[model samples]
Target: MAKTSSSHYALKFHRTSTWTMFLVYVILLVSLPDSSQEDCHCQNGCTDFPGSPCPGTTCQPDWFGSYCQKRNIARGKSTSQSSELQGYGGPFPSDKAVDGSTDQTLQHGSCTHTGDTTSTGAWWRVDINTTLEIRRMRIYLRRQNTDRNMGLQVNVSDQLCYTLSADNRQQTVLNIDCGEALNGSSVKISVNGPYLTLCEVQIFQCSNGWFGDDCDKQCQCQNTTEVCDKETGNCRGGCAAGKHGPGCQQECNDGWFGSYCNKQCQCLTASEACNKETGHCSSGCAAGKQGPGCRQDCGQHHYGVNCSSTCGQCSGTSDCEKDDGTCTQGCQQGYSPPLCKMCAVHFYGPPCQGCGHCKDDSPCSVLNGTCLTGCKPGYEPPLCITACIPGRYGENCLHTCGHCQINGSCNAQTGRCERNCQPGYMGPLCIQECADYTYGINCSSVCSCLNQSEVCDKITGDCRTGHQSTTTAAAGASAAHQGQGYDDIRLIVVSCLLAISCVYAVITTATIYRIRRSMKILKAEQMQQYSTLQVRGESSVYDVIAERSVYANESIQRHGDQDPNKN
Candidate 1:
């Protein structure tokens, strides 16, 4: 029975040991990362805080992570389905190597340093999830193993691309070019060392339509090739036609113009349309157009593109000057040179002032209005601009007529008496005087009897000397010589009338003193005649007495003339 109990205990112990081994294996399987999950390095602290050391040197600011990989899948939870990495023990599992965490970097209690046991020919491989044009690969060493050199060899899609045999010295990172952009989806790294340690493994593929390291640069191939240098971003086959410059952004040369330099030039013919930028006509403006821009028409009185100027009022056969409008030949009859416009009738000069009245009806000089002849009437000249003063007349007002009846005014033009001349003077100009023996009304009357002198009154023509008794008869005969019977009769009748008037005046003056004496004598005589002449009447007697008295006076005057006055 002790033997049976020992066997039962051993069987129980064996079952428990099997279950423990299964459980332990299950735990390890749960902890180990699946190779089909986890794609691209996140670059962790380096990506989050630029310029911070990534712990491993493989990733730089120009790249993404310790392995300098590219992110090819959609980020977050979706990234795990896109890729995987095959490796060994780390803070996490081998597939977690590319999660972008370093040996020191931890997240949620998980660390991402991927390492393997020290064994012969340890290797790590990455499935990039999609086909990619792979150019370069970098490996980041475990930060803790500073002195060790793991001579690594890299292959892309089963093609051996690079070997690290020449750089066997200890290094934090390693970079290798895969020759051309090797068409591949998987990258494998193997090292001939005791073990392989990788904090992270990364696979790179350029983003869609990109070809450079970080896929941050764009390709500018103008011809639609859309291909350029992966590093320099230079066009692979040069820019397309009609394009120039390194970026293929410039157009054609100077002589060529237009959108694509497709249009030919017209400036060669006439030098028009010359400017490349503005396409303006530089020279040779059209017929009527002028100005620098060839946009203006000729100005007023100007013609042609040179703006040749012209003006009005030109005369003579010779044409006017286009530049200044000056007359070339002589001026026209009434017009002047430079401008031949006519002047007003009375005005003359270059600018035609008043001509005034000219002497002798003479015309003035056309140029200066100077009176050629003397001034007319009251006017005087150089220019005939002034008039004569009061009582002055004739050309230049130099002469005077002294025979005016009252004030002595004369004609301004002729210097003749405006009215009749003075008593002795006659003629239109009042220059003639009465003759010595003749006078009165144009000197037509003759001198007859005189009282004082041989001369007669100049205005009346009556003799001034006294005449004798013999002269009276002579005067009558002389009167006959004066003209016709009218003169003879006129002289005799005037003498008799004057003698009768003198006698009447003497009788009337004497009557005042002898009125009473004459009345008494008349009364006595009338009484005697009144009775004797009663039959004849008183009126007849008085008439007879008046005749006798006139005869007596005449007889007495005759006696006194012969006696040389009784004094």
Candidate 2:
């Protein structure tokens, strides 16, 4: 019974506690601010607020501040005021305007208030620290005394951006479009009234290549490198290649091409257009022109289509015709007219120059102008155009000339002396020395030396003997006569001596003949006496007489006598 009673009391207590908690939750829900209303006031979504249970809100894109009313660009930037408000609720500075706050209450210290109430031009400024292309501005005016913001002028870098009239005096927020040209690093707000007060200043800049309200438009720039006008979207630099017009969306017209369509085509037909991108002609080039663009003229010595034809041999330093190969200035000296391709009668080579002097006045080789039959007298061989040099002559200029008078040259054909020969020299060439016993020019002078073997000087006719002959012509003749006389005398003497020798020989022969005859006679007589004695028988007497006769014969023979009486 006690446990059941305790359980029933605990159940009633639990019921009473649950009803009280439910009443407390309902009261809290009714007392709190509407979350949906708060969310509606916020631009983006809400976040937790500092020191409050309620959530805070964030700004939309390009917006800032607690209420999302200030531009993100001008928030927290450097600020200044022409003068600061002094005394009670005074000291309102310019920095309060760009503090990313939209609070309009002057006592909240979120607005700028100039102290000079008597002066008309009270101003506040902010330096964004960077040049920006601002298209619009949102000015938050002080709710109380809104007349102070009337006749206010907004300037960007000293250029007038907008002006607020008296009709805008009661407005808490003024939306002003400054247009695309209003770009600057600093923004200023000035009132023509006595004082100036601004709760906030918002600056809105469009994104790159976008402009106009909400920055929903894109730019139409011709050059990709250049930026277009923020509002008008016009290319400020120029149109791109093959494009024309302000927006750079049109194609090039006929006969025009390249950048801005400024270049004209150079095609073979005057009405034809060229390539828009490269300025090349589709058709062939005009006459005397070459290359893709047809702007280049033909090269030197070349003409006609594609410069295929070669020029002819023009006269002097002139060039040939560009349309044809004709020599407009005339052909060279010995070449034919018009094309100048053929050479004249006795001419040769490319220039058709005249030939050299050949033998017997004959023509030379047509190709090289060489003397085919050999060169004429006094000239060199081969070309045979030049005469022989000094001291040289003959067919090929091979033979050297002889020594001539006064060192003069000899005849080129015969090698003969031009003048008389030198002294001691004779002959046509003046190369022979004077003959024996002769000297001087032409060997006309005679030698006067005593000895015939002696020679004389050929140049001076001087004798070479030990002693010189001083005898004149007449003296020489006389000496010659005397020599002849002495030779005659010698010849006579020799003749006489020969005659005496012959006589002596004749006398000797006679004496010898007589002695022999006497001896023969004596012998004959001796034999006769012996015979007579022998016949008389007187031998002894005959012997004595014979002996006496022999002695007598010997003595007669020795005496050269033939007397038989002595015996």
Candidate 3:
């Protein structure tokens, strides 16, 4: 109720303003003084406003009726609501009026008005800001009649968008030919009173076109030009060259594609896929396509009717699908079909995604026991169907599943068929490789051989004996072929040691004999050295011999000294 009261108050205020403005307008109209018939004052009005003056160079000339009466009647209107009941606005100075010298029929009377109602301020102060696109225009008259001579004029633009005058007010239709698409805030309009009032206006896209010679009431406004030919009504834009629709706008008959499309999607067969651009159904599918999306595989399902859904209930002739003759996984024991895709009464998993009661372990063999590729990990059921019950793995709740022996899923990668037989497997797919000290085909059976013994080939579980060349081999023969048989290695080693010993004795004897001869020579050289360096008593032998000769000389000297004394 409060909101409603506020709206009522605002509306009342608006009506009061309108009524006040209307009263002022009427008072001004009544105050307007009549001019003499001789006055031709349009000569000055033309210079101020855009339009040319009347032929006599003044308004109210005898040639025309009284201008004020005509102008007032041309723009007047009846507003029945209890608001300001005033006539339309009057002419303004500095306005642009249409060129009316040439055609008198195109002119408006002397008193012209120009204004727009705006919410920002005084409505009469706002400028007409719509820039029209289409070229032709018509003026609409309310009640003011005499101000009809003035036409429209635009000050800023060189190209013409529309024409307007009081005469056009009488004409029903108008054409606005826009030379270009414009983007701006406003377009100013100056009609002859050059008088003007605004209804609503529109702007069109570039490349506007018209058709149909008699289209006075109708103009087709559709983008119809991309079509091929006019006869086909298929030029991409516009009504096919020469034709037109009701309001200069209607779609073509056929052979076209667009918002004005007259075409259809096409392909080879009626069911075949079609191109969006062209309307014709042409080439068929590529190699594999049968149903729709080139989707099929006779090599996979091995069935009929475009290999539709997996070949169920197959006939006998095509037993199982084979690529280059490799026997594929076939059907179950109870059921035998062409593709091996289905199962009989109590069989499933590997055969059909079916259900059954697996009574015994041996009966599992009747269906091959494992799921289609076996359940994922901890998951395991009757046929490895359900999970292995959290703690258990393998076919039944038989083994545990954890980091598994192999790097993959232990229960899944290897079947827990072996009962604590070896380290690698406990159930079935003994996937783990041989660990240290262990070697066997399935790592099932242990070998009693030494570490890295080359004692046996684990894969075959047969002793791995190496070979040797008899001619140069230290062992004298290959372990496999020799009488040693891994036992004769010691014998060959002893023989080789004995042979080395005999050769060593012969070499030792020759070395001893040579050493003896060299020793004898060394003994003689040592004796000479001893004689040269050894002393007898205090002197060496050489020294002692020289002393003896010296002693003899001394004795002779004694004799000579005695003789000299005698002399």
Candidate 4:
């Protein structure tokens, strides 16, 4: 039985030893450093700080400190608020306790108030100059105020962050954590108690785009960089050239221009680009422009790049536009657009004006305003659009026509007098007048029967008076009595002459008888005897005398017949 008992005891001891070894192994495995925590590595021994509450191996993202437990960000970025209360100590300023210091306490250096006021609605505030994200906040309560029971409230950015009841002499500190950080710029603390006091108030920075304890500043460093000077809140190594301002959060204004907008621009005129740094004109200042800043239009005679080249002489005082130096108003009289150098053909007047009366659809000389062809109709030439001047007509209005009765113009092309001539004037040119015996058009018609001194119609040849001239009447009578032939007129004239001669001879014989009677009886007898003697000797005296008289009478009759006007 003793041997069996010994065996049992030995078996039990072995089993117990095995159990103890297993327990030791489990403890060893749990106490050793975890190899899987490699990614939690920290530089500069960030996790070796004394009095730190952080774990030694792992760090949360965006958290870096002596113990890998603190976040580098901003806090209290906006205004803070507090309920009115008298501090227990002599004038303990609220700002003194929240000044990032823990040395002050309610009895001596902290913000404290002594009164029987209710704990509810009592508050204090701190102002963060700017908006920010707040990660956490720590409060150091007065050391001597353990007996006071109070409900504490903490708010961040006007939103409730924490609520707690004070423990009986168990804790004098309060720490509020905003799990994901609160978006705010201010911190507020409120408590309902017999006395309100604080030693120090501390706040941690957030993970968002902010830094500094007051959260009044922004992080402008490159997004690739993860570290900054936590105290000064400066971006490490400064910002890139394109950025400026405290955190390098601002970009340069867009004043740089040319090529890449990297080169500084120099311009003279307001809001214009220039070539020189001082804003003067230079080569390549701007395409197709002149003057400083490339702002002005090219001169009337200049064009192309920088207006360096001379343009064709434009007729008018117009110039090219600045953008491309194109003559939009059209080049000068003789020049064309763009360069304004090419010769341009144009009609007279503005663009809408017609070619006037110029013939053959011909163009005019744009430079001189001259017509290329003759005029049309009433219009004269060279420019040809105008009507002929008074008394002028033909191709160039060069031919002058006769003046009309009312001084009217003549035919434009034919040059005929347009209206009838004044009274006495007649014919196409009005050059002829009424003749003494002839009148009217072409002077072809004879004047009507009237006195020679009387006036007659120039056009109709009508006599003014009803009576005829004596000479004309006589001629008519003579014509009626005689035949149309000249020979008949001669015979009538001869008869009248012979009758007059016979009467004249009889008168002469009577005058001779009277003279002989008076001379006497004495001569009468002698005369008779002589006469009888002569007659007997030669054929009688009376017969000789009578023969001679007959011959004289015949000659006189012949002469009278020859004279056509004698009658």
3 versus 4: better lDDT goes to: 4
The local distance difference test score of each candidate is 0.56, 0.72, 0.39, 0.57
Model 4: how far is 306 from its true place, Å?
A: 15
| lDDT (Cα, tens digit) per residue for candidate 1, span 1-567 | 999999999999999999999999999999996443232233443343222334454543335533343442311111111122234332344454565544433333232333333455656667766666677665666655644345677777788887766555466566667777777767777666545555555555543233456654334454465655554456656554444454444654544343334433333235454443333345544444455334455565443434554434445345554334555674555555555555545557666556778876676877788888867767777777787765778777887765766578776777777667677677777778787655665565555544423666777765546433557735654655565577779999999999998998888668745865665576576466555644534578756765665675576567546842353
Report the C-alpha displacement of residue 216, candidate 4, in angstroms. 6.8
Choose the strongest candidate by lDDT.
2
**lDDT ranking from best candidate downward:** 2, 4, 1, 3
Candidate 1 lands at a TM-score of 0.29
89-178, model 4: which lDDT tens digit per residue?
466556655554566455555454435465445566767766766656777777665555267777886888877654534466766665
Tens-digit per-residue lDDT, 123-236, candidate 2: 899998988766678988889887767688999988999888778778889888875567689999998866888888888654455444554344445566676665555677
Choose 3 or 4, whichever is better by TM-score.
4
TM-score per candidate: 0.29, 0.32, 0.20, 0.31
TM-score of 4: 0.31
Candidate 4 residue runs with Cα over 4 Å from true position: 1-160, 163-199, 203-356, 377-386, 402-409, 421-439, 442-567
lDDT of model 1, residue 303: 37
Tens-place lDDT per residue, model 3, 379-465, is 445465465443365444456643234333444324443233334332344445565334554465444432224444444444445
